[model samples]
Target: MTASVLRSFWIGGFEGADHVNGAGEPLDMAAATAHLELLNGDYLRAREHGLLTVRESIGWRLSEPAPHRHELARAVQVATAARRHGLQVVWTFMHYGTPPDVSLFDDGLVERFASFAAAAARALAPLHDEPPVYNLINEIGYVAWAASHTNLIHPYVGDPQGLGEHTEASGYDVKRRLVRAVLAGMDAVRAVDPRARFLHVEPLVHVVAPHERPDLADLAERIAGYQWQVWDLIAGRLEPQLGGHTGALDLVGVNHYHSGQWEAGTERRLRWHEGDPRRRPFGALLQAAWERYRRPLIVAETSHIGVGRARWLDEVASEVANARAAGIPVEGLCLYPLVDRHDWGDPAHWHHSGLWDVDHDTPLPRHRRLVPDYAAVLTQWQARLPGAPPLPIAPPVPEPLPESRANGVVPCTT
Candidate 1:
């Protein structure tokens, strides 16, 4: 069967994670960057670019601050806004943040997560008549890997020393836990809304063994497979005990960056630029995921750190074109953090990876000024997209919500 593509050819990504930064401090992009306070303006800005879809966070940390009891004021507002703006919402349930009272290693972790996921879906049901789209448990694999492999943040649970340095086993124990959490969350969403769709957002990568360690070529391939373990588990291809079925898995969203390529079993980072024989093209990496899952694929997250913003976007556009040529049904390319953000390790240092950059020293809703140079480049690149959908003369206005939903007792229907 042919893979599916999104209704809109491209989408925008809003940073909404409410997690702590590497320096052991909290980082709620929506709040820190005034996104929450100025959401209406943010939506207007994004819509102005002709984006009919956008990614947002449900703020698990905000809701369920305590066990059982839940607060969903913020989530309700976001869902309503998306409907008002007529934007297809792909909400992120867990953006690397859980309640302070909960533990990822707790015996009831899965059940606790399920309750929250179901609750979020129910709250939005009245707002969204179509099947809900979700990036359930956003980038869980990266969360576990970063915490365990580096001082980026404290490890989630067991193995404070990290499994990466251990020589005894596969070192994928962290990845396994992430997959389990995802399966549980997916089940929860389905229970509440059977028509729910998922986008398993994970980093796509490539690696090779060093010349001196030619014997490690096989080992390198195994390490590369680590990236596919979660998907494989969900598809029930690799681990049958995970309770995953073929139909449970949905679209695949890969977060790719210039530095995603690297040398396995070492600290070497591979270049992801043009004409580098060593550098693998983004299309090749995307094809690997598409071929394995046989599902629609999207470049869910992509951006450059500095002045290379324009060039980087141009390269990604080429990758999207190539993906289309390969019959991969590549749906969209999202520029994450459409607004520039602070560094995770050093909040003082800003990364100029966005089309718009705000002055941190300024006050809340710090006027998202456009980066003229990058904006011009983006315009040119967007126009050059091979299969880009033409912009509608007027944005669609969502249907007026029925009065029955005001009672808050509408039963969800397929």
Candidate 2:
């Protein structure tokens, strides 16, 4: 039950972020995207497209709706569905949202999270024959930055709307607490099932000095350097009090997006399409992560909205291929939000960022129409990667759509 292996190089990620938004309303991306209701079809399509592995998450708020009490019916349902589809799962225990009573700054957060983790592990472990991968927390840096620094989620800054200045000190505090919670949760899960494998997922980004702000070069470098802090902490290279050690850093999961590269301290994003020399190659980022931790890497999350989706897939897939050729052990690339989602801040706004777009007119389990262009790009890349099953038929021809409609529906965030 402890064997470590991935059936294919490609993985699909269900958008399972169940967090309270800036407006103080709970948002469930999986339900918004209809992934839960359409679970069977989604998995069948993923396997059909050669995506044999998937990234999934348990809604902590739902699983542990109350303090010290646990209910994992949905968690078991997802595990059963994955097993039935013959897919391997990468389970995320905490995805930003937690029980309302649990506070990030509280001493009890660590213990509460550990208890919930052990409960979930016991409930789901028997479904799989091989060791199941578990990500204790998804995007630790982003969660900290949101909850403490800025306030995109809970622990709002000034007013209830969560609009206010960033707290530098609070940011560090939240990060450490989150790390400790992960360590504790890992130990608990291991106690329940020793075969469990852990994945440390963090955002991978590059920062550069704006041409006008040459004086801020060092600051920009420091910002870019922050990406490694969490991994270091997990490996006991930093903040040894958090109970971090080498074994805690199992599989390194990096979440990168089109907006991942940017000009430090400014609104300008370093253009990936344009020849922004400041922009680093995706392969280089992967190589750097591998060199730093020397662990098997996974592009845990990556996708672009609208018309940019196909091109983004092509670029990411190419970079992954190049990295593997250069001997970087990138186990897989997950096309996240496998289905398009409605924005958390604005539910009316939909980001056509997934391989399949949603039709609003349809009922619960809405219609999922595959984006022909994206499918074509995926098919091309799957043929190049080893272990990917060949598609039985060619992807449909893409329907031409205006770039404005495809990419400009709404400004990208997160």
Candidate 3:
């Protein structure tokens, strides 16, 4: 049989956003999730739950602190664990974490990124029997907006130039650089592995004019268009741009969440549930995305915090099924942060959003316990998927431990 692009329709992703926090402390999710230490167990847990495809990030800063000099220890461990557990991994080359020395606005950023990609491809080739799938940079559009528009990264608005800090104007420079880096990185990776596939993952959002500010509808629509700019440039739809052609894009990996929709002028987040009239149906948005790009798509990232978690997953499964039946060519739905993660800015705030609820208070992989409510819903959803296999029976734990300190995902579900 020909090798499948993804092992199954339902996939799981580790939250690998390696960004600098507000206090200038580095936040490494790989460390937070206890991924490297229990990497095999995590893969095993996903496999038993019938999630054979996993998404993970290889930290750019940790892997290659300097240009040209590459380190593949972490990436290799992740790949090896997946291979051993019979899983297909969606590797992300850069998850919002760039080396300290590499500046996003510098002229040579593209070249440096391409070199890094080529080095990574060469290093990862031995583990994979086929061309590996990659999300080159997780949500570059968001990254650009955060860096230029918000106080997230460098080039803050408070700089001495009197530049308009948090507006659309700041996005031009950073967005262009991100596009160039992707275009250059694609060429470099393809040079090493001809069959390599890429996913341009961007956050999908909806904007509505506030009741009192109907005139702001246009502004909301314009901001919504920002989501498509990166894909547009790659598809040759953006005019006066270079290196973009019809087939430049391979897949559309959209990262969406309950908070995606918001007021246009005021930017107030609209509640996705509770029958909000302004909220658009997920299937409708998926259809729109398909009509525009004409490429296979995946819900790359999605989850809700607290009790809304199970309800959200059920809704997403229904939408994905509807889209597939309607011939949208929808590939998969990934449960992002399969292992729970802590807040980037405030460590005290736990999202409680993962199938596995991890304890972020204690240091070291802390405790990754299964959220029984969410896992049950996920298992049922998987059974209804096309080509989904029977979930393997989990091995019994030596003794009953408190729910707070459960070790593996599947075993904890009992």
User: Which numbered prediction scores highest in TM-score against the true structure?
Assistant: 2
Candidates' TM-scores? Answer: 0.86, 0.89, 0.89
- Name the lDDT of candidate 2: 0.79
* Candidate 2 global TM-score: 0.89
Candidate 1 lDDT over residue span 101-168, tens digit each: 66554435666777788888888777776777788888866776654555455334335564443211
Mind sharing the TM-score for model 3? 0.89
Superposed by TM-score, candidate 1 places the C-alpha of residue 58 at a distance from the truth, in angstroms, of 1.3
Candidate 2 residue-wise lDDT, 17-94, digit = tens: 888987788977777778888899999999999898998989897677778889898888988999999998889989
| Residue 221 of model 3, lDDT score | 85
What tens digits encode model 3's per-residue C-alpha lDDT throughout 317-364? 888888877877767889988988778877667688888887655576
lDDT of 1: 0.71
Tell me each candidate's RMSD, in Å, in order: 7.4, 11.2, 12.0
**TM-score ranking, best first:** 2, 3, 1
